[model samples]
Target: MIRLGLRLTLSGGREAAARLAVIAAAVALGVGLLLSTLAALNAVTTQNNRNAWLNTGAVTAEQEHAPSTADPLWWLLRADNFDGHLIGRIDLAATGPHAPIPPGIPRLPGPGEFYASPALGALLRTVPADQLADRYPGHQVGTIGDSALPGPDSLVIVIGRTPAQLSGDPEARHVTSIMTASPADCSGSNCRVGTNSNGMDLILSVVAAALIFPVLILIATATRLAATRREQRFAAMRLIGATPRQVSAVSAVESSVAAVIGVAFGFGLFYLVRPLLAQVDFTNTPFFLSDLSLNATDVLLIALGVPVGAAVSARLALRRVQISPLGVTRRVTPRPPRAYRVIPLVAGLLELAYFIGRRPADSGGQIRAFLPGIFLVLGGIVFAGPWLTMIGGRLMARRTHRPARLVAGRRLSDDPKAGFRAVSGLVLALCITSAAVGVINALTAEQGVPQGSASLSSTVIGDYRHYDDHGNQLDSAASPPEALLSALRATAGVQGLTVIHADPHPAPSDHLAGGLATCAQLATLPTAFGHCPAGAQTASVGPSFSVVGLDRLLSWPAVWPSAPATAAQLQNLPVDQIVVATDGSKSAIEQARTLLATAYPDQEQPFTIAEDRSQMSQRLSGYQQLADVVIAVSFPVAGCSLAVSVAGGLRDRKRPFSLLRLTGVQLGVLRRVVMLESAVPLLVVAAVAIGTGFLTAQLFLQAQFGYSLRAPGAEYYLIIGGGLVAALAVIGSTLPLLTRITGPEVARNE
Candidate 1:
């Protein structure tokens, strides 16, 4: 019977063939996206694990504090938090040759030589080797890959020296140490650290999993839309003595065939796109081809699972449709969706409230608790979609006097589930985009972050690097260079120039090393800097004061200037170490910074301005770009799915529409009905989704940071409104199909 059903479906003439082809193509595209994303995720994870293994052993141990120097295998780590990222400087002799050396480096750094990460190498390349050779003591040879570190732009420098040689100060605190141990010796609880590099990969995989939900929803919607006409044919089978069970089985088989075909095509598409996925560089460096590979088991799982999922969804969609001969022929209005349909939404809201109400043990606990709430809320929105659609339909019907409005309203009321299904993908897209825009606005608003008086300048000049000019000396005791100081005071546009000097000192316990900042040169500073000590003594830079402290002291970090620098000017200024902060008029300070930078005859630009509003905006710009990419990809897919739904509806309603045309209903009214059928529900669902997203963001921000929400600007509304218009355009594209279905010949054919 299944074979007969398959043959009937496959050979059911041009219309069935075309419909099946469309369904298959949509499914294939959806599955392809899922598989490709997963493949890319796996590739990145593999590379990260390999890099971590090379960085530390398979079963490495890490202690919060460095272990005693009696053990030669433990590498002492000193983390210098620069900017927002961590730069790890590890003692290579203590770590030995634990990291796997790729073909690039012939051997590990022997004695004075050091290996830097690719990111670190990029930073080092900007500084002259002669300047670096003194402190580093050897040639800067090669770069390490991500296997050594997780962050994309993290700068890790592995110095070739024993811990004892690196530092003799016993009072100095240690941040963490990577232990070199055999896998056998570091089993289970004995291992101080979990060594498999799956944390990032797992997070990405979960996100990928979440991402597929909408794709599945889209596929199901497309299948259901395309099946509208097929349902009538199945009913005829029932009339010819086919049992309902038989009819369902045949439909399932037909769908399964299409699904299998789609899955096959999906695999091909994934394979074809592997190289493109490999090119994706989330880590700044593109992943190797080997990193992006999917295992045989994964490939098999995708091959089997997607088709099975598609077939099951098809069966479920068919459950509500009556297959009886009489029922198929007669006009039967579907019962209004039950009020219980809102139960999940209410439960999800309750869950969100509870999550928000509870005071978590820590930030981590709050985040963990909050994730489930997010899922629940999103699930609730989906669950409540049909109910919301039905209400919109009932309201529209209640208020409308026009025939077109009456038709659209009644159709929506009779089949709210279908209406919701048609635009489910749009709802998800709206929620994501709305939430992203709202959060981004709150974060990037000019008033979002409190600005200090220090930042209130038309122009500012600064230096970021503190590299030693001579060689391997710590240079912790050196004061600001007299030449640079004299030059800064001598430069044009020199307002009240504040020289914020950084002094590195050993902290007793909290950190491996610390810096002290004195607001000695400035008469006034930002309020956040507090008061400089009574004397010239230095205040230790702690968590509140670290690099973030510079922002408050009227002295920003070593920001490299954006204006072009000449070779002669660059050669004259100190590249790595110099003075920061000279404020004046825009042109004056810039010229002053240029003159100060070029004052030294043989130094690289003495200092570059590192801390400025431009830097903050640049960070926000990255976030904006990421958000735009996500929306750009998702919105089009959603729009296409909507187009499919509208097109399928036209195909399904051919006879009814034709009858309306024959009964003197205006063609324009019928077109309006079609438009409202899709547009009204879409607009309604998008509004609900967007509102939910905004409220969700508000609650989350308030709970996490005690921050009050800010209203998003007009631009955010414009973006969302643009998406709605695109959806409407998709509906408009199907008008020709409506025109064909409502023609006189359509009625005669039916």
Candidate 2:
């Protein structure tokens, strides 16, 4: 039976050859996409593993307070921003000669030396000493290797500090050994090395789900191409006294041949495109090419799974022929899809709506509540597609007046499930695209600057007060030394400067509003202080004295306070805040920030309004980039499935179309009929999928983020419009094949 199947598949004339070719091509495309997804996931895992050691396990308070030993190393990590980029700085101090060292470096550095990643070294060389290089407090002795860095573009530095310098810092930890994995209890700047945050993991889950579904559809659709013809042939073998098992074997052999061929070509395709895949920045940094590759196990699975799955799909599709050969020979039409097919979809929508209305408080709870709804919605689209297509077909048959429309409508009405099957992949793709685009739109739109907040883009604010872990005041400079103020004024971009004095005996209830400044001095920052209260002198200011409080104030919806104060009392106050207005240039801002860092090393870093907004935009862009890549990959796969289905449909109905052509029907009319048969069901389902996607997005946003729905951007429109046009183009390409397959030669009785 297997031999017979092989010979028939190989030399069963042009129709058989065409069928094999279409199935092979479709399977090949599906295989390639699946492999690419696997490669990308592997890259992410590889990145986390390589950088995990830096997260170094935290020591307990008891261990930290114990007697000093050379075996354990003391480490403190801080994040510093230069321009809009994040630079990781690790401060290390050794208590003895045997202190443990982290991966990818030689001996621990002495107090005056440091090590920098290659990217950071290049940056230090390019940027001025005052702006960036001087902030490190040491000379570079060596370059950190790739094993220690997450990506080629990562900026990291390891600075050597004395034991006394890190003594009282509560954030410091003593580590006897490096961690090989991310610690479960790790949080904040120290946890930046290996693990992804909860929000990032959610986005990745969404991307994976969106991509995998369409590829699965493509594979299933591929195995069923030319299914009608295969059924008749298999039924004939069943009628010839061949056992059912033998018939199944014959079918499997035929399907597996094409599948094995496709798997080989798919492997080739993945290797060819691996370099380009490496360029995609999933985590805001491009991965190394070596890291973006599949391992031995992944390769083995792909090799075995594709062919076996194809064979099984083919065998299952012939179940009707095996049970009763006469059913297929007599041309039986299957039962119409029932309304129950829509139950999952309706249930899913209701579930989502309920969850949205409830609005769970914690992130974990929200995710748990939303997962079932999300899964139901996805499953429902697939379940309800055929029923929706059937209803559309009945409406088309009832309403059309033209001859081509009449014929197309009746055919669709008869096999509405088949009509819907052709575009199922496309329906899923649009749903994912619409939902992703909608969420992205809301996130980006809501990131605009807060209202009533001052536009102090050119100003850098720094406070010179230091606090311990217990929030106890450690050191508070009454004023910046006169020499330091003179040096800052001479900086190239320094356009204006002012000082804010802290009230010596601030009331307990008004501690946050203790900073005092005269009207003339406050007027220099008209954009921020906003025309300083009319005729007021020495007004008390709000939390603009500290960088942390100022950042919060700018983003929150509150007015910047400027209540009048007595000059006599203000004069006795000490200087607490230094605000520098720069010339609104990047160079000037960096220069001013560098001066502040040099003056107050222990305080929180200074920042401008522009940097704050830029950081938010960068974070949002990462989400957008991920969605864009998924959409880009999905559309092409959907288009391929559409093309294969169109070709397969034409091959299956060749005899009927040929007879129609011979009975005085023009080829152009038949073309119109074929076009309607595919287009009507496709357009109808696409609309439903898109609407469902947008609704799901709205509910999800409201439930999880408390955000209102925002209109999608131009990119959303382009994706939808271009995808439909491309799908139509795929349908049109298969039209020429119609004239060839449905010619007068095809009208003869077998």
Candidate 3:
């Protein structure tokens, strides 16, 4: 039977060959996308393994008290007990001639020989060898290999000295030990390596898994469309005494052939694109082509899964047609989609309601609860799509008097499931685009625009420079000198001398008038507060703002002028200041900042400028990049699905369209009919999908982030409008095929 199927397919001539080729091409594209995605995942996994090997330390313990000997430190550094690899370190000294070595060194060095990690070695080389001994109080002998360190980027140095030689300052302390993985722990080739802890692997894995379903759907839809023309042939075979099972076998054979060809082509495609995929740096480091390759198991999965999946989909599509001795009966009119399809949607809404009613206090917890709700809502929308499409078709039929509309509407009403499936990819793309735009808008809505020339082009002062890696300012850090402040005040361009002092006490009341110098200054700023008393100190007080009344105050870093600053409430917090130039010129402001910086020769905290506009642009740019990625992945899938549907519809209607052409139907009318069939449903579905997405995003934003809903911007509308236009374009592209199928030659053939 399989041989017979193959023979028939080959001999079926040009049309059959063309159909097979189209099906194979579509399948290959889908398979290639999936394979590339998997390959990228493998690359990430490989990079993770490399990182794990480099980061040898697995566990760490901290001790407040210093140990008597360096033996415990060596144990911590080189310990290989069953309780995972251990490493820990404590400060050895502040500034002295004799100091204990830092962590990450493989072994204690002799008095004249000290070892450093590559990063530390680089730093040591920058300083003169004689100065290194005086400044670092250690003999910099050599650098340690990566194997002895936790990560290649680490900066560390080790010194060999007795406890008596170490500094006795209260802040001076030595690490008892900093351990690494024992050899046995990393012994076997099959041992699992550690992963990069950025959580991107899990996220990418989840996204890839989600994408698999849609890719498979596209593949199945493509194959089903390709086989629509072959249904009558299958029915005729059944009439000639072929069993239903035999008919299925024939389908399986045809599908398996196409799928095998496609999978092979897909592998070649993946190989071609592997280099491009290697350029994507999700972890800030580009992965090698070898890292992003398909292993043996991945190859086997594609080799077997694609063909089997295609064959199974073919069998399922053919199940709706009855095969008997007389002939096979194709069900032109499908049953109405069930209303019960909405149960999931309703249940999801109820779950959201339940969650909202509980009113979870923690915003993070609310977001976690909302994630499951999001999935449920998506499933509901997908399952309910056919029913919605049916209703839309009926409404369209009633509203229009044109023959094209009537015909297209009836067709959709009859097989809404097909119509729904055809537009499913498009609808999903639109929804996701709308949701992303809406959420981004809502999050950024509260940000105020910077006022006047107060842009980052000017110089400002803050405590940013004095802070160490741990965010604590160095003890020797001092306020900007009185001379620099006076010089800046006397500078020609200097304008707003706003000193944002750390308020030791702010009135706890939530009245704007009390925080402001007077109601007059408060009136100059945009405030949500209403009704103020005529006094410098009103009964109402919440947050304090500088009395300077600068409109460009929002440009300052980490400064929320209207909102209560928790940082300001801390006792003895350092004061920060912003110097805006009168001319509001970037060069002038920059010149002022330079002069201020020069005042403090050993400047720990340098002057800065708050360039709000550029910062906002950068933030929006990032959001746009994210949106572009989503659109790139989704739009093509949807467009292809629409194209496939049009092709399939034309195939199914070939005879009817030919008869219409023979009966004096104008070519333009026929074209209109085709356009209406694709265009009307798309317009209706896109509107519904976009609306749903926006509302879903609004609800999530309100519940999860407590952000006020903001209207989507012009770009959001443009994306949705573009999707509709693209759908129409895809439909139009199929018209040439319609002309070939609906010719008078087709009518005369039968």
TM-score of 1: 0.74
Candidate 2's residue-wise lDDT over 362-468, tens digit each? Answer: 65576678877877887789889988888888888899798988888888888887898899888888988898898888986676443233336667777655567
Per-residue CA lDDT of candidate 1, range 488-551, in tens?
5665545444433332333456441233343443323333334444443333332212134333
Give me the runs in candidate 2 sitting further than 4 Å from their true place: 57-70, 168-170, 183-204, 295-297, 357-366, 443-459, 463-478, 486-514, 517-521, 529-531, 545-578, 613-622, 748-750
lDDT of 1 at 681: 89
* lDDT (10s digit) by residue, model 3, range 30-84: 8887898788677656555543322222332223333424433221121010011
Which ten residues in a row are the worst by lDDT in model 2? 549-558
lDDT of 2 at 574: 62
Query: Candidate 1, 635: how far from true, in Å?
Result: 2.6
Candidate closest to the true structure, highest lDDT = 2
Give the Å error, residue 648, model 1: 1.3
In candidate 2, position 670 carries an lDDT of: 91
Model 1 C-alpha RMSD vs. true structure (Å) is: 8.8
